[model samples]
Target: METVEFYNGNKMPVVGLGTFRVENNDDCKEAVKHAIINGYRSIDTAMIYDNESKVGEGIAEGLAEAGIARNELFITSKLWLADYGRENVQAAYETSLKKLGLDYLDLYLMHWPGLDEAVMIDTWQGMEDLYKDDKVKNIGVSNFTVSHLEALLAQVSIKPVINQVEFHPYLVQDELRRYLEVQNIVAESWSPLMNAQILDDEVVKAVAEEVGKTPAQVIIRWNIENNVVVIPKSITPSRIDENLDVFNFSLTTAQIEKLNALNEDKRIGPNPDEFSGQ
Candidate 1:
């Protein structure tokens, strides 16, 4: 797997295994453990998922089972909206660290942009404090649009190193990607392969046929080819194994253009900008 560098000089894998809606504490742990044993080093989790502790336990189990060292893995966690203030942000991170059973996180992100200026400022401060303390290797945001990022940029001293968002063929965020590239922020993808809208699209099947891979793999390879870090989630072993098969093939430029044309600014997930007051 390839790696991307954060402004702080942290190395993160280009592809990661996502743990979203990973139900049943034991089951979630097992998936994570198996994913690691299968060759995944980057794992994404969030405090709001209420599975941090389980994920930590799974990681511990996987490390012991596979003899993978702690430093060899890249662990990421997020601060929830309830913990948006300065004090609460720090407190939340401490709790997350405890749940994750780690001394420091590879990446710590704001789960969502605050509803107002006060909360946003407080959250930024909390992140800044963590960055200053060297507890979070990389500080970033999720579900942030260009305007949302600009708002935070005006007040915060340290710019976010990354922005995790819903990115896939049907929801290509061209404008956002360009803006982030200009800002030198790596764009991390979520819900990258779970786009229900495109699962039945003829283009997906066509691309899948040409590559002799699933529509999911085609979309994921599209992500990797476009320089986006993909975090695809799956609980089944075969599906997990299938998702990692992107490393063996490359998409041609024409095929990429065809996939890019599938975007209609349609999002399979919620647009926080409208409801979150971004």
Candidate 2:
């Protein structure tokens, strides 16, 4: 799998396994192990996902089974809203580190903007401190809008290395993508498969047929071609293998244009502006 060059100079895999709904220890551990054995180099998890411990165990198992070094994998976790305060941020991050059983994290992020601008700044200071201390190699944000990023960037000494949000062909975030590119922050796609809705779309189907691949592969390839890191979550072994099969093909310019034309600005996640920073 290919990797993206992050602001911290670390290489993050372009494709990863997103353990969003892998709740139980058994399922989460096995799914992650299977993913690594099948050639995944990155695994994204968060406190909100509630499976960090299991994920850590799976990493251990995969490492022992595959005999890969620790630094060869890129692991990312996010700080939850409850831990957004200055006092709580550092402690919460430590807890996450302990749970993940890692010497250092590849990336750590503010899951959402804190309730107050001051706290957001404070929490980011803690993140900056962690980065300096070598606890985490990179610091970033998730679900942040352009204004939100601008707000934090204006106050903080260190800019975020990445901003992860919902991105797919139908929910193309052109303006935000352009802004982030200008800022030199990479955009990570949380739901790059369009919730499987586009798997049956006529345009995607046509593209899939032309490429001799499934619609999901077409979409994943599109995301990578767009320079966006993608993590498509699936517990099923077959689906997981299918999702990572995107590296074999490339999307055409006109086909990419057709996919771009399918944009409807749809978002499955909630709007951040109306969030009141909570």
Q: Candidate 2 clash total?
A: 0
- For each candidate in turn, the TM-score is 0.96, 0.96
How big is the positional error of residue 3 in model 1, measured in Å on the Cα after superposition?
1.1
Q: How accurate is candidate 2 locally (lDDT)?
A: 0.87
Candidate 1, superposed: residue stretches over 4 Å from native: 195-197, 276-278
Tens digits of per-residue lDDT for model 2, 79-182: 98777766686788889888888777898989887457787788888889888877788999988888889889998888998999989878889999999999
Please state the error at residue 17 of candidate 1 in Å. Answer: 1.1
Q: Residue 99 of model 2: what lDDT?
A: 89
Question: lDDT tens digits, residues 253-278, model 1?
Answer: 99999999988888877787654622
Residue 13, candidate 1: Cα error in Å is 0.6
lDDT scores for all predictions?
Answer: 0.86, 0.87
The global Cα lDDT (0 to 1) of model 1 is 0.86
Question: Worst lDDT window (10 residues) for model 2?
Answer: 269-278
